[model samples]
Target: MKSSARSRLADRNGPLIPNIDIARPRPYLPRLLKHLFHPVFAFALICAVGCNPNGESASGKRKKERQKTAVVEQRDISFSISVAGEIGPAEQVSVRPEVNGRISELPVDIGDKVKSGDLLFALDDKDLQIELETRRTEIASANLEIRKAKQELDVADQEVELDLRRDSITRAKLEQQKAKDDHARNKILFDDELISKEVMQSVESAYELAKNAVLQAERNLQLSQERFRKAKERARTNYELATNAVLKAQRNLELTQDRLSETRIVAPFDCTVLTRSISAVGQAVSGSGGFNSGTEVMTIANLNEMIIDAHVNQADITRLSADMEVDVAVEAVIGLTVKGRVERIAPKATVRSGIKGFGARILLISVDARIQPGMTAKISIPVVSAENALSVPLAAVFTEQEGRYVYVVVDGVYEQRAVEVGVSDYRFAEILSGLNAGETVSLEMPGEDAEVKEMPAEKDKGKRG
Candidate 1:
């Protein structure tokens, strides 16, 4: 082994070492060979397995394949706004009684589907029915009295006509004058002894009787005129009274009928009853009149048309309006997605947890039987979307006190460049200025002596599970 070491050394430097004695190996030779040759073997093994075939370090290979970033390219970008909301019915109402009375029948129970004008509850209406009947009878009596009064007026008018015929003063005067002439002729005949005394007396008596008949007829006519006037006044007053009574009775009947109609509590629209508080058959209810709030019988909801009331941040409210498209997901119904549109954005803002936001209603376009009220809904609204715009990954965009910027790989070097950023959907941001299309950006900083791999940065990472 000694001569082999000398010959190997002589090969490198000729005649550098002199001849040495051929002796047995030393005691520490094993340890020396172990240490020396072990390093050489380890170096050969490392060259075979540990380093790249091209003589690059393992870390250099890793640097070559390190996570590369995306480029600022002209691509259609849609910035979405995420807000949490709950699914609810488009219409909900609490039912109450309109007339105060004892509940006679509560036919509809909880979870019962009902249509408009369907009877849900009934109140005791016996009193109203009796009152209506009494009003009707009064109306009949008034009509009968009106007929009687009209007949009395007719009789009074006929008597007035009879009196006018019997009391003619001019005819009475003519008869009296003729009687006087006849009596005077008879007296003259008696004085000349041509006629008897009884004849003149008889003529005078007939004239006097005719005159008295005329006076009695005139007096009877005056009395008949006064009586007829009084009868006419009385008849007019009685007819007016009867007609007014009829009007009053009719008004009363109408009021009673209105009250009777109130006794029936009908559904205002097609809905499903959610709750019912009234149970006993004889339970009392109150009317929603004056200051009374009335009793709540049940809660009814229209579940056919569902909506999601999403409270959006006030900062994003300006971008929302009527008919904005949206996507909705319900946790209760996994893997089911429904499309919707914004119905309205509330004018007023609501404060919750110190955050002020406007409530936006998203009306579901599709109807499903499995949908129910009060389900948690996740709403996605795309507020700002730009087509064929330069965009970059969000991680590449860094914020500073002045503005936003990104590290772009220019000439194989990371160049910190200023950039103008527009809307961001948390995964990618639209680049407005200070960056051009096809400019490569870095997701991470490479080491001082390392090369950056040209791998693309992942997009839409937030959407992944």
Candidate 2:
């Protein structure tokens, strides 16, 4: 029993020896844990202190220091106004027909340069010539009729004069016979005293018959004189009527000739032909409606004086004036800029698509060979400009209830600045006052102060260590 009791104690002691070896290594583990945990605990304490609301961290302090050293820049600014315009000739003359007629011969073609009084086209003159010849024949017939009437009047006057002379001689002979018979009758009366009284009565009857014949001859002479006067008057009236008829016919012939001359169209001034409407030589054209109502057989325009007709919006019209300088660019001839001036402005606004715009005419100060009529152009009008002026980005200027203002960084703090503005374009604004060159300005608004802090490089390295 003693031996068994000793063996049992040895077995319990042997297991206890292996457990002690493991326990010895466990003490070293506790020591390592203590060494690691002390530094972690200290780091936690430091983080808690720095993150507290009462105290600022190292990163926060560095951000404030950098803000104080920020800088800004000043730039020279320019302002310009741009508009789309069209290039055209300064003068445009529309060639229209005065009297309508068929285009018989078109002498000029498109792009032909012509001078004043140059023949442009001709109309058919066959009908006009025929009418003129007919009028001349009528005039000749009227003249022949007038000559016949005058000759008849002259014959009638000569006949009346001869009849007057014969009637006068007959009257004188009848008077002498009447005197002799009376005297003879008186002598017979004395002798008849012894004879019959019937013989004396016969002599007295012969004397009375002679007296009546003389009175009739005198009346015939007076009638001849009156007939001669009437014939002469009629002749004079016929001659006047015939002369007027001849004159009228002559006038009609002259008028037809003039119209025939007008058939040849001519240019009124120096110009270039823009178009030609007729080419076929045998094309039939109506005499009355061939080229009226602006149906141009050809078009000519003076290109030396070229002008641009631009439509300016009503909002910008108020700022325009005569003689203002402008730069024009034509789309047809690219990379060319022509100088021009505001020549005229329309008195009223024109509404197109419910937008109101006014017509403005721009005259080219100098002629350009590249500029042509109907070409589109882009116009730049300089409203105002300043050289070497204080300026900033347009985005930097912000409006408030007072006026324009900008945020300027001063001494690590953003301060609001009131600035006077002059002019602005798409990119920049001219700062008239309240800002200087080389000053720092913030492009973005600052958030909370804590949000702007940056992590320190030393802290990140220490954490890695």
Candidate 3:
């Protein structure tokens, strides 16, 4: 009998087998097998299986694929502006000979270290020596002339005194003549018999003596006056000529001495000799020399200190100052970076390739021995550094009408969030506000096909329940 059936199945010929065995169970296995394999039962069993009809797996995958996101976290952020420049000596000069002559001696060679006043080269001073001796001789001769001039001046003074004496004699002769005239009148009165004999004799003697003295004075005065005039003329002429000779001698001496000093080339400051162009003992060089402006005997520079001449964009100039620290990396020195500070910034901008830039000088605080001039250096100027700041990949941030923003995933849905940005770099940007840490943000726009769809309120409630 079938399990669903309460009686045993009977065959067309009689019972194919006994309906029941008294010591065993009824023969219902065949009926039970047939019932279990019925189409309706199979349909009901297949339909009740745990297989999903809503494509929950596909929906889950779509939800995960809807967006690629990163968690917001705190990190140290910094900004820098890169510029190209060349390394050079802090102080450099082209050594030149101060005097025009053949180089007599060159004591210092290329790459030689030198101190202030150290000898680098010498000029042939034979001509200068001869000129110097000549000047010395001229000075000695000038001294003799000066003495002779002084002596003549003294003689001229005596002549002037003699001339005055001669003038006094002329005046005395006139007074004597008047006294003789008075004496002649008194003698006439005494001779007329009205005057005393003593008065007549006294007048006669005085007049005679005065007349004799006048004659002698006139002769002496004429000779002395003529002698003084000639002496004074000669003395004045000699003194002036002697004074001029002395001055000329002194000037020539100084010129010759200055030329002699120029023969030895001295180092203006402590430096390293970079190059030497003159080596032969007799190569003539001029201070302002041929082909090139002044003969450049050698090039010397202070190697202990170095500077970088960099071109900075005008837009970034405001962020730099003399005290601002900089990072310098020389291309020739691999993996080497040195610290430096801004030493100067050009006030005017230079136009290059239609862009404006300012020239800047960066002084290396501690220079390395390996660092040389003319190396190309890439410098990084520090702008700002923010520690423990909220930042995201630069790609994650976007700008729209609402301003800077990022896509945040909320309930598997992308929501636009506005953010305030601060310092930034090539890799990331700092978020100042409008966002919190640990929030997930989308790197790019999410595809609509991969997005999760929200159901109605009733359906959602039912699904939750």
Candidate 4:
């Protein structure tokens, strides 16, 4: 009778309670009776043996039915490449002096905003000014020397005229003609027996002496002209040397003035001073000399426009192009997202830290004050995208020998169907054809024996649930 009753209870409750020998007599029969009759224990036993088939609880069946799957839906899907980069000003400059000098008057400091041509600093110009004065004095002295040489040249020219007049060549010629006439008259008389031979000889001697005087006069004139020519050449040379000296002095003066102007440095453009290398007003700085370029005086930048430098994986670099729009997020400023455009992409690939990638520059469409140089930025560049496309979880799609496919549930059975897939991100894949919205697809591969059915036509796609 006890066995029959225990079997009956097991049959009614579905075997959740263990077989206990409750029909046997025990010293703690009263305690056992009280515990077995408690409401909590009875309710727990009923809950354990829930009203479901095969002695399994309702929750067990629900859990078993919860296999990973996704429902196809019409949604926006895109493929993007995300990368980490750094933000910087589009135009930055390291300011330096053009000439070596001491900072005499520094007007701009770090963080100062300046307009184009505003004075940034000044160097001491006292020495240059003094040198410039000396150059002017030299030029004046050269002018005086030029004037003195001109006077000497005029005196030498006047001496040439004076010496020519003093030679008396005309007077010597007249005296020679008179002596020849007298000698001719005396010779005719001596030959005709009208004068003595001694007188004729004396007249001949006088004529010869007159001819010698004419020759002497011509020699004197030639010597004086040559001396005058030499003197004029010397004077003209002296004048040329003085003029050259003045030119040299003028050139030196111009150089000194140029250096003086350089003492005042001005801003090249409208910008903000980002750094100041000099601490005080008189720090010395080097200029471009030999192999040394110069001592950097300060740094400035135009903060209105900014750029992000990012390295993209070589596999994804081929998809990037100039002027392509992208999205940017600043790490320093939380929740700050802005639009950017691709400015350039490196032609060659570079390896950094054992990873090969291409360097790309992205220009910010708009810059925020909070975005600063050296700030970390995240860039999302879209390679491909689709709007309101029929899509499913990426895991739901699979590729096999027959091309890409998916296991879609139809009539409570997984049916393999070939699919035309488009762009896919990390989460969803765009279905170009072969699948319909409202259909369910298995996330994991179904059994090999699952029938591969012919997919619907393009017009009939997204019609079946």
TM-scores of the candidates in the order shown: 0.66, 0.62, 0.67, 0.73
Residue 204 displacement in candidate 4 (angstroms) = 3.0
Ranking by TM-score: 4, 3, 1, 2
Taking the tens digit of each residue's C-alpha lDDT, what string does model 2 give over 1-465? 012211111121111000011000122335544664588866865786678787875444545654322233455545455677777665556555555556677778888999989998787778888888898898898888789777877776667575766767587676758666665866566586744556566666667767766776677777777777788888878877887888888888888777777777788888888877777555544443344364457778888888888888787787688998888877788788888899999999998657688989998887777677788887776655556656666556555554555667666666667666654555556565666767765654454671232222221210101
For residue 233, model 4's alpha carbon misses the true position, in angstroms, by: 2.1
Off by over 4 Å in 2: 1-104, 137-233, 288-295, 320-327, 339-344, 378-390, 407-416, 426-428, 437-465
Each candidate's lDDT (Cα)?
Answer: 0.74, 0.65, 0.75, 0.78
Worst 10 residues of 3 by lDDT: 456-465
Query: How much does candidate 4 score in TM-score?
Result: 0.73
For residues 138-233, write the lDDT of model 3, one tens digit per residue.
989988988988898787777666767667677778868888798878867887977898888887788777777777777777788777778877
RMSD value for candidate 3:
25.4
Q: Candidate 2: which pairs clash?
A: 89-306, 89-307, 90-305, 90-306, 90-307
Please provide, for model 4 over 78-111, each residue's C-alpha lDDT reduced to its tens digit, 9 standing for 90 to 100: 6666788999989999988777889999888988
Task: Name the weakest run of 10 consecutive residues (lDDT summed) in model 1.
Answer: 6-15
Q: Which candidate, 3 or 4, would have the higher TM-score against the true structure?
A: 4
Strongest candidate by lDDT: 4
TM-score of 1: 0.66
| Residue 67 in model 1: lDDT | 54
Better of 1 and 3 by lDDT: 3
